[model samples]
Target: MCFRKKLWSIVLSAALVLGTAIMPANMIFAASDNESQLQAMAVKSGTLQYGDSFKWTLDSKGTLKITGKGFLYLSLDDLGDIKNDIKKVVIGSGAKEIHFSFWSFSGDASLPKLAEISIPLTTKVLSGSLRECENLSVVTGGKNVEDIQGRVFEGTKWCQSTEHVVLGKTYIAYNGTGKNVVVPEGTVAVSEAAFQSNKTIEAVTLPVSVKKIGSYAFKDCSSLKKIHGGSSVTLIDYDAFLRTPWLDSLNETTMLGKVLMKYKATAKDYTVSEKVTQIYEGAFSKCDNLESVTIKGKITEIPRRAFENCTSLKKITMPNTVTNIAYGAFDHCSALAKISLPSRLKKIETGAFIFCRSLQNVQVNGGKTNTKLQSIEDAAFAGCNNLKTLTIPWGVTTIGDYAYGYTDGGGDENSERDMVQKMMWGDEESVPKLNAANIIGISQSLGHYYAKENGIKFTATKKGSALKKPTVMINNSGELSISKVVGATGYEVYDKSPYDKHWCKAGTVKAPVRKYMTYELKGYKYKVRAYRETSTGGYQYSAFSKIKTTK
Candidate 1:
């Protein structure tokens, strides 16, 4: 994935440079002989002038034709005095999108003569371009349109006659006066603001085919108390059910299908249920009363700002299934003191734990042997003044700027003062250098580079040993003997067979008794490394010796 991204960036850079060299400045499309003949019969003809992509020609019959590739940029002001003269609009097949400067074609002013529009099959989204055009009655060739946002045709003749406006598989708008509403089958998506601000809607039933509910889909429906039939829904945008009685009625936890939408309760302690597989962004944000949370599920990520401003939250337990800690997931959780990351965690996004002043400890990979962590983005642990030391794993290749203990006066004066008090109170030994924290990891790792670059104190966990590598000898009887090294406390034996993908630990032999034997030694390669016990009860290892096999 990284290689592909780099390759795509290079290709885009080269394409941009080549395009700049070949394209002329202030260039406009020159009309061909056929186009010139067609323009002669037109009432008006001009380029969009914003870009060379679009051109417009209004015929004598009051038909406005738009030809464009990529996008059609239009506005009521773009028409100038000819706004009232347009009766029909035909968009070219090459146009994939239409962007209007204003929300709609007719807003303060009216396009009374505009009655018909023909969108091409290539256009996939219609976003409030012809809304409130009261005279617009006919629409054609929008079979490929998949998304419709805002009130695209609120006052139009086509929308006034229909209660439920569905385009393609998308439910675009609700114009019904009924209290109980049932969305038709085969509808796959509910567009943004589809049922917004409708006071009479008391109940809504979605079809099994509906997979997504856009933001503000059912917002401000005061009387809406029930929503049924969302078994097939996989995605529900934030605030999809905002300001509705149904959402307010959900006490404690609000869940829509497999997604946890909100935590409404004032409880001091909470645990996410295992049934929920996903969590929406900011689900528990600003929950000041929440003190402890235990997440139990197959959730792969903690969404952005999921627990921001949880001032009382001090503890959080995450399951091993979580692999990503998204950007600002725990921002300003001032009381959070310690966190244990999961073994499968890969990346810690920017500002994930920023301004958590009380944070003192962070254990990565759950203190396990192997880690899959790759990167720790900028300011991941910034403003964590209380964090004295952090141990980075060897597998991590990138340690971003200010990922460790860093303090600033960016509206966090109280935290900075607390750190200063600790330093002045003769407890300075527990506090790390200002803006530079103590880091512990294997020698020559990225953690060392980060520490050296930031003037932080670094301690190598696996330092080079003075003891020489132990020699491994295998005889015909498959008895392997490892020659002992001076000043070594023990030797670790590793073996790799033809079928093995990695070297496996065979056994460890104490010093002065280094002779070792294994039954499955035949057709297997073996190596040995000597280690000396450190004062901290850890081992410092020498480089592995040459591989040996039984004759």
Candidate 2:
């Protein structure tokens, strides 16, 4: 049978190239007494049909051959109980189109015995078809099948063989138990479960034409060590390499495709390659030690939850190529003290940078009045307790619910303004210093309008003139004291200690008093600094004071 199939294949190829009218494959059903005789001698025979659209004849040899001309839809359930007994299938060459369904060739235990199937050259196997066929093997024909779905041969012997499985032009599966495997070039996709549950394969190199990797494509390849090439892959389904050993050590991050789906790297300062165009959902979540990220890619949109809960990410460099920041992209990045937004950033989605408690400053290009920034989603900057300076671009139009100016709970309970008021004056009773205020932006448009509507203080620049630096000392009464700078109207004290972390504004002092202003202290090794606040609101400070332990 193999020799005959090969010989016929060569003849068909030769005939096509030479433009000769060759007869179709061996069997051609005809109306005759001989056909009636064969039917009588058959073990089982019947014509299955879906109205007038499709029809097939099931013969004794377990071959469900297409009898209808042009096109036919082969749905497994439509074929009677004999469907389970179909060991081999021969789709007629005359059939131009064949549509398969999820229930077409699935879930029947007897499917394991289906030894071979011959699909027409023009068939289109849709997604979620013929999945989990544990033992059926030897799929032939379909030289022109264009849209073969992932998992079409999953759990089947054809997918588990020690050979690369090529269906039409797509290299869908590789069950080779070698230490190294090289995917054939020109293959467009790597289908789902293509190498699933395998234990021997150590490395696989995908070709560049491969644009998509289906879900769980390499789900449990326990020994998969390296994946090389695949520079052109645009979409990688999450968990494509789940439970694989090579995920965490993927040093060449760009090979994971343009869209980073799951990142388990432990690097402290990760830099995304320029080839990466998008960062997919949960790409870098829960990286506790990640201190900084330099995204130099042309990523237009940061997908949902891309970097959520990365508690140690201190800083991020956004490239101008970023247009839209998606929902929860950088949520809960607790250590991110400051971030610089790109000039072209258009939208900030819901909770994009929410709960970043240590976020103190956000700088965007204030000169870019023609910026694409349109909206700031709900809670986009909420829960940012230490946010001291925010430079809203002039193009920002809409601010969603609790966009900024508020914290975790709504309705003034955790408002950032209240928190700063408490931190600066200890209570609202004491006079407030200028540096305690949040510098709104360099030049504002709608942000100023909204701030006015919401009674939020916003200004294009700091309010006061710059003042001279103040001196820090411990006063005789056992309190931390800040000596007033000569010509300054007031002084702002800050506790800078990595032991407690973050530069927190401690207290404020009015100038012109003879004695140094002081405060009763909570003992901690602190590197304190005093910046003099001008009568107009700008601040100027000397170098940081020496580290001192509170007595």
After superposition, candidate 1 runs with Cα above 4 Å error? 1-40, 43-55, 68-84, 94-96, 103-107, 110-112, 128-138, 150-161, 252-254, 263-278, 285-305, 309-332, 337-355, 360-551
Displacement of residue 14 (Cα, Å) in model 2 is: 41
State every prediction's TM-score relative to the real structure. Answer: 0.51, 0.45
**Stretches of candidate 2 above 4 Å error?**
1-54, 59-61, 66-74, 92-113, 124-126, 131-135, 145-148, 251-277, 286-304, 310-551
- Report the error of model 1 at residue 284, Å: 3.4
Lowest summed lDDT across 10 adjacent residues in model 1 is found at 22-31
Question: What does candidate 1 score on TM?
Answer: 0.51
lDDT of 2 by residue, 190-278 (tens): 77767778888899898878877777788898999888988888877656777887875554443466777556666899888887766
Q: Relative to the unseen true structure, what is the C-alpha lDDT of residue 513 in candidate 1, on a scale of 0 to 100?
A: 85
Candidate 1, residues 301-416, lDDT tens digits: the string is: 99889999999999999998888899999998999999999988989998899888889889986664247776788778877778888888766645665577566544466755
